[model samples]
Target: MTFGQQLLFFFSAVGAFNGLLLGIYLLFIKKLKYLPDFFLGLLLLMLSTRVGISVCMYFYPDLPRIIPHLGLSALFFTGPALYYYIRSSFQQNQFDVRNCRKVFGILTLILGAVGLLYLFFPVTWENYFGTFIYTAWSVFVFITVYQYYIFSKQKIVSHNKFVLPVLLSNVIIFLTYQLISTGWIQVYCAGGSLVFSFVLYANFLILFNKKYHQVAVKETNNRYSNKKISEEQADNFVSRLERLMETEELYKNANLKLSDLASRMNMSAHQLSQLLNDNLGKSFSIYINEYRINEACEKIENGSYLKIEEIGYEVGFNSKSTFFSTFKKIKNTTPLLYKQSQILTEPRFQSSNL
Candidate 1:
């Protein structure tokens, strides 16, 4: 009838539908670890609880209140769940059950106790918690963004194609939400003033689901079809190759080839080549040189007695020109420049001496 009523009905429909999708994801989707699944479950519960509260607020304002600010209470878990969900999605094997369960229990107790208290004494509570929860979530989000920034600057997060989309989605969700809340040109909700959390919620669900499937497919591929080298095995092999290259013994082997490294590791040349190209995200020549570049940088910084050329040769680089080019490509700077700029040196070598 009224604008507010129409807005309320619209949100109610979105809330119910989101709750249904979340329920399906939780009940049916198999996870690699309990933490991710647990976090997802909590996330869904929060969405459902918020939807219920919205319905009551819109239609039955006079009904006995069980949870004052149920929607706000749900917002409290949003940040923590989001953080854990992203982490678990990336690192399925390292997902710890105890820590995850403990965090979930603590949040549940805090929110559930507050909800029950509000139900019994609805007049005692206030709306200050809403702002508090948002501020807290903002802090969590910024921390993750900062970590990603560090990784990018260090060149550790090389796949900017994937990372950028994920980060952009989060930024969009954050900016859209703030705009909707502030009543500054609403681009999301159709009916009225109430911001549709469901849109952002669906965005997150899709993002996390994509990440989950990526990990799941990799894991499944590794388990089956021993005849063909799976994606996960290739990834694991590259990790092992990196670790092997870290050792002084391994780095000393100049003129090393894919077949040579494969022989050392007891793997076939085809497998190693495929692993380097597909999973490690580099060609064989580039991958090997990147490792050498890292080693050369370390040696140049710490072992001041060793000449740059000597260090480069020891790390499997054939010539000074090749070493310099590879180092620049991987580190985004020349070996000499990187050493002078990044490495910790004695005060005697400081710019003041110049």
Candidate 2:
């Protein structure tokens, strides 16, 4: 190969090869359980395989035909993985890892199906696979851009500003290939590889920027610490929790834990804690105590034979002092005073108590 050709090969090959390595590291070596990381790894793997195959066939046109087919198979899922990576990145922390695994399973089935067709009907694949792959890719890119537009319009609090470059990168790579395929750009056979390498490294630089990490870490922490769930989400969480409380009387168990409540709500313990603190404007303990205090009030009104002290234990409090203090704070009166008021208002209670 000529010197310029060698240079072209070296730069493009480096990006594709290193992308493969990074993809493997993120998928297997990195221990993070975050959904975005896993999807990003998969995206990288797909793109790397696709780009590597493009680079090889462009430079050495006589290579095995199966090499291109292998790369085409990767293309089948590339768009889906890209879209998912962005989606997962924006998802709330409660987005379950199990769900992501399910997505992965579905994508794998798609890839396997495409591979089977490629194997059994190579002629059909050679004729139509490229159109299907590029069309899928273009649609995903458009969807991603549309997502950015919606997010920007709503001013959704996230790192979507970073997505702009990624969107542009993919657009450029796609256009480059489209131009070459249409014979509009009379360039080297590896022109698509050239753009792919450039964009791939641009993404790498964005990822490695110190300010990016600082902002990302800060934003993530700030989200959990300060950001409340959307009103809709908050309402949904409250309704679900209320239903659980009414049906199960979970707070009646003195040993009831935050994790237990969160599990009932299908959320993480931290998510429930955040919900209580930010959305409900209370701590988990206080939230549960409010339920207990209300239950205590109902018991007092019902002319229960048990004394206030026993009623406290019945409701869930561990001690007389705590129950009395919490009742006064919640009800704005001592338990006995509150009970006497109930007796005065409700003749039945007075009759039963007397």
Q: Pick the candidate with the highest lDDT.
A: 2
TM-score on alpha carbons, each prediction: 0.45, 0.57
Q: List residue ranges in candidate 2 displaced over 4 A.
A: 94-104, 159-161, 207-354
Residues 1-354, candidate 1: write the lDDT tens digits.
589776667665675557557755774675523445655565556545555565555565686544536566776776676566555544443346588779779877876776666567656654545555567667766765776566556544221123454455445555554565567974434322133345545556777897797567546644652556677776677677777666424544444567557656656666677676667667878776766777687777675677777677767776789888878888889877877775556565776788
Give one digit per residue, the lDDT tens place, for model 2 in 229-337: 7889989988898887877577766656886676567666777898888788899999999999999999898899999998998888878999999998988899999
Q: What is the C-alpha RMSD of each candidate to the true structure, in Å?
A: 14.0, 13.1
Candidate 2 global CA lDDT score: 0.77
Model 2 lowest lDDT segment of ten: 155-164
